[model samples]
Each structure stands twice: as structure tokens, then as C-alpha cells.
Target: MRHAHKRCEDDGNWFVHPVTNKAWSNYTTCVDKDDLNFRHKINKLYISGYSVSVIALTISLAIFCYFRSLKCTRITIHKNLFISFIINNVLWIVWYTTVIRYPAVLFSNKPACQILHVLVHYFLLSNYMWMFCEGLYLHTLLVRAFVAEDKTMKWFYILGWGCPTVVIITYASVRSSYPEETILTPDSHQTRKAVRATLILIPLLGLHYIIIPFRPEPGSPEEVVYEPISAAAASFQGLCVSLLFCYFNGEVVALLKKKWNQVFTSWKN
Candidate 1:
């Protein structure tokens, strides 16, 4: 497919191939020949469902945040989970509506695209980091129930704000080594490597789950009872697992199917 901003003429109004010096008409055909009907229907379904979910989650978080009394309870770790959920949903909404819809802008405008790209990556990393923190906090409460009530506010701030910042800084540092000309090509092997790395890194959530449950605590009535930490750990673990299934595994399978179909069609033609 031709680039959206392909230079045409020296005067800069025409579509010209830089390599071939071939001038093309201003009017270009759509890259995908599929009818807009199915695409539009899919887009509507995605936007409506995602928007509703994000709104509901955000409202729930706001209500919880406003009630400071509720935040003091052992169950407040769930509030952290709620906050993480809201942030992630917001990221998804922005990603789909802005970034995904403007692929050309992302590729053509380097500075703006890089900023958006970094922000997107930062939040995506933050979502998982916060989930890992949630699991850690939950496990701590389960094993050390009394301590869960002590210094809850301090730990809450640390986990919610501190961890994401650290992760973002680390990512930015690593990304800084690469040149600005690093464009992701369609057949890039680095894509697979990055995916593999992410998958390996995300499972570190389970380590938090394991560590929290190992902390020492006195055997008391509160200790015997299921703590909020355990619940949060379980909830976050379940979420991580489900997301892996739906987002990674399912999406990969669908992508493979689409690629295979395209290959078969090309061979037939």
C-alpha cells in the first residue's frame, strides 16, 4: 500500500514515489477492499462496550476514593485494584480511539508519535506492575493480618504511585539507547523477542503472590480468617491469567489465521 504522505511533485501537491519518481493521482484507492459495513459494526461494538466498561469502573473508583473511611479498611486493597483497573481501561480507550485510529500519524510524525508511544508503553507496563503490587499487598495481609492494618496508607501510596514511576523510568532509559530511525517492519523478528520478554516479565506477578504468603505472622483469630490480601492476590492472579488468555493467546491465534488466509489467497491468485 502507498504511504498516506507520499511525496508526488517538487511543488509538494502531487503524490510521487520517491524511489521511482513516478507521479500518481491525488485520489488513491483504499488499502483494504473489504466493505466498510463489517468494519463499522465491529468498531461500534468495541467502542460501546469498552466505553461502558471504562465509565463504570471509573465511577466505582471515584466513589471509593471519595469515601476516605472505606479506604482505611482491610478490603481497601481492592480499591487499589479498582484504581489500576480504571487506569488500564483509560489506556485502552485512548489507545483504540487515538493511536489505533491514527496509524499514519504515528508513523509519519516522529516526535508526537514517540511521545504517544512512550506514554502508551508506560501505562501498559504500569497496569501490570500495579497488578503485581496488588498481589503482593494481598499476600502480606493473608500471612500477616495485623500488620495489614498498620501503615496501610504509606504502603498504598508506595505501591500505587512509586512502582509505576520506577517501571516507566527504567523503560525510558532502555528505549533511549535505540536510534529514532528504528521503525518496526512487518517481518521484524524483534517483535517476537519483545513479546517473549513481556510474557516472561509479566509472570513475575506470581512471585509477588508467593512472597506475600510467606511472611511471618502470629496465629490469631484474624490470622486464621481469609485476609483482603489473599482475596486481592487471587483476584489479580485470575485477571492476569484471563488477560493472557484473551489478549495474548486469542489475539495471536486470530492474527495467525488472518495471515494464513492472506497467504492462501495470494497463492490461489
Candidate 2:
């Protein structure tokens, strides 16, 4: 996909599109059959990645919910983060399967599609916000030896869910005033065994956004490497987070093992 921009005039007005005769911030670039096929493949990878993430997140969520012993401030925060990711992934899956897959649905510019567009971004923002809450909570715990869990949790709830609502409302209100524009937009190593795990997992967790602004020019040699890396980072982020925080967690692993052994011994008896 290409990113085309309209330059603002010196008088603070905007440049208009020649075809639509309306002020536009961005416009889509036309692509050939080869590019279109490439995009289809990328989008399929996205669907598959997101589907796997959703399944992993759902199972993680269930594990956290089922084990009453796992209840704590940290696990509570993890639950909310998992929830945000779950909703975000489900919405994205819907979007790719419906809006992106069907040119008619995308171009028809219906109200439902527009609503879906807003919902997708809203949850996307929530994903980051909840992540921020996670970091904040960790910092607070480390810095303040006796931090109040209830109070911190209240703020976390507001930041994780409420802040995104405010942002999306402002964005939607402003965007509603404009004409609809078409959608267009726009990794690395490890030590031996440890290095290989880091290389594979870091992108999956979407940590590659640290260099988002450094995107190479379209069709450049760098883009050849950038595209698939970016796609994997964005698509598999939820799965990676769940694996690290849930499935790979020592406490969670211990609880699951104990429960499994209990059930097995009971059945044997």
C-alpha cells in the first residue's frame, strides 16, 4: 500500500483532490495486479495470525479466570489487557474478512463499515493504553513498597478503557466532518538459543514499532524486508503477549500442572 499526502496551503487551507474536488489529507495509490496479489497474500497472513492470537488469548483468559488462586493485582491487570487484545483481534478479523476482502464493501462507504472502522481503531488504542497501564503498575509496585492495589486498579481501569473512548470520540467527531478517504498505508537477531527466541518473539509481540517512522521508501530494497516483518509484528502481537505473560508464566504453569495432576490422580483412583 502507498501513502500519498496533500500539502496544506500557506493560507491554512488544504489541497483538494482533482477527481473528488474536496480537501484531502491522504489518498490511495493505484497498484498493479502483482501488487494486488501481494497484498492478498499479506492479508491472508494477517487473518491467520490474528485467528491464532485470538485462540491463544481466549485460552489464556480462561485459565486466569478458572484458577481462583491466580487472582491478584497483576493477574487482574493481565486479564484486562487480554480482554482488550481479544476484542481488538476479533474486530480486526471481522474487518479483514469483510471490509478489506470485499472492494465493494470498502468503497460503498456504508454506515456499518464506517462504524466498524471506528470500533477497530478504538480497541486498537485500548490495546496500547492497557499496555501502558501494565508498565505503570509495575513501576508503582517497584517504587512504592506499600502501594494501594484498589486505588491503582481504579486508575488502570480508567486508562485502559475510558481513555480510548475519549480519544476515539474526538477522532470520530472530527473525521465525520470530512469526506471519506480510501484506506492506504503502510526485524532481527539473538544470541545462540536465547538470540533465536528473542528474534522470533520480539516481532510477534509487536515491539518492532520502535522504528515505525523509519520505514523505507516503497519498492526500495529495504521494503522487501520490512513488509513481512511489519505484518508479523502487527498480526501476532496478541499471541506473543499471551504466551509470555500467561502460558510461559511460572506461576500459571505450576497451577495448571497441579490441577492436571489432581484430575489425573482422581481418575486413576
Candidate 3:
């Protein structure tokens, strides 16, 4: 969905609601009506954005996988980045088509949905972790060219895949303690978003800020207002990474051009 709150314990403001539920309920129409509109918006904007991202990401992945010469440490990490986005997009698509579209399943709260819920965020955290790895690799290679690439990649793997589990476990543990309807179960949207932002920022300077999700009223159905920060951050991940790591990369572009020319020359022959 275009809604950022879907994946997290809750990205639904997705943790950045400027208005309280008491105020929200005052002006908003029927709860079901608002939720319906939200669902429609999510399916339209989120699905379309993610679809385009998936196509672009596939092309980016192919560029790296097909070219043996371009398989350097940096580019390998780029492939991992693309792979993370790919998995995230695919799982989200599965969520939309399978669980969400079928209202009965969503409200039924099937075990599969819970698994999907966990998986969706897991891969998302994985994406951030790998991006952190990307920055780390860059810094290491630039400052110390003598370091062994394999060792560096090994460490990257452990951190990128391992770290998110801690967050997810903490999230699930905290969420489990509360009743299902409680808003606190899912951490605040901005809190989760800031965590991802912090990962990208931590290496730059020593500055750190811990922002958590802004929880809504305990039982207010209308508390789930969508926020652009979490929504845009989560939905547009594939597009951002593709542009940053693959589409905009000098090496990837050159390789793609070389492949196109080779294909064109073969066609002419």
C-alpha cells in the first residue's frame, strides 16, 4: 500500500501524526469510509510507485549479474542492495494482491499475515542495513585501499543481515505484550524512519538521535492516519536505491551502454 504504516510495528502516521485521534475523529467521516479511502490511495499510489521501482530494479540487477567484469566488491554490494529492494517489493506485492485485497483475510488476522508482516519489515531493515554496509565499504576502500575486500564484505554481510533482527525482535516482543487493538504495539512511524535515517547518518558524524513512533490513543480506530515521511520512505525505496547505486552509477551506465552496443552490432551483423 502507499501507506507507510503497513510494515512497521506501525508506520501508519506512520508515527508522525500532527493531529491527535480526538481531533481526527471530530472532522473525519465514518471510520470505515476513511479506511476505504486510505486503502484505495495505498493501492493506487503505493502499488504504482513500487511497480515502476520493481521494473527498474530488475533491469539494474540484470546489469550487474550479467556483466562478470563489473562484479567488483562495490558493484557486488550494489547487487545486494538491488536484491533487498527486489525482495521487499515482491513481498509487498504479495501482501497487496493476496492479503489486503481480500478484506476477510486481513481482518481474520491469519498466521500467514503475521509472517508476512514480520517479513515485510525484516527485508526493509535489511535494505537499510545493506545501505549502511555500502557506506562503510566506500569509506574503507577510500581511506584504506590495502584492506582485504573479502574480509570487508564478510563483515558487511553479518551486520547488514544480522542487525535488523534485533530491532524486529524488540518490536515483536513489545508488540506482543499489548492487546491487539492497542496503538503502542507498533512503534511510532517516525521512530522507525529515524532509525533508518540514523543508520545512514551515524558514520558521517558522531551525532545520534533516537526518534520513536508517536503512538495514538489506545482504542481509537481513527488513529491510523498516513504520513508522507514513512510512506515515501518505505514505498519509494527501490527507486531511490536504483538511482543511487545502479542507474546513476558511472560504471553501471558504461556497462549497460556497452551491452546495448554489443546487442545492436550483433543485430546489424
For model 3, how does the per-residue alpha-carbon lDDT over 74-116 read when each residue is reduced to its tens digit?
7787788788888888888888778777865766566677778
Residues 1-269, candidate 1: write the lDDT tens digits.
64444445577676764434567544345544343443444444445555565565555555446545444433365456555655555655575677657655544546666666667666555656555555555445434434534566577667666777787777767776774443013133634543553454456355555646564464344533333444345334434433443235443446556768998999999
TM-score of 3: 0.65
Instruction: State each candidate's clash count.
Output: 5, 2, 11
Residue pairs of candidate 2 with colliding backbone atoms: 190-195, 191-195
| TM-score of every prediction relative to native | 0.51, 0.79, 0.65
Superposition error at 176 for model 2 (Å):
1.0
Name the regions of candidate 2 deviating beyond 4 angstroms.
1-31, 181-206
Q: How many backbone clashes does candidate 1 have?
A: 5
Taking all chains together, the TM-score of candidate 1 against the true structure is 0.51
Off by over 4 Å in 1: 1-30, 35-46, 66-69, 73-75, 181-269
Worst ten in a row by lDDT for model 1: 179-188
Candidate 2 residues 179-242, lDDT tens each?
5664000011112433433444445444679867898887678876787777788888888889
Error of 3 at 97 (Å): 3.7
Cα displacement (Å) at residue 252, model 3: 2.2
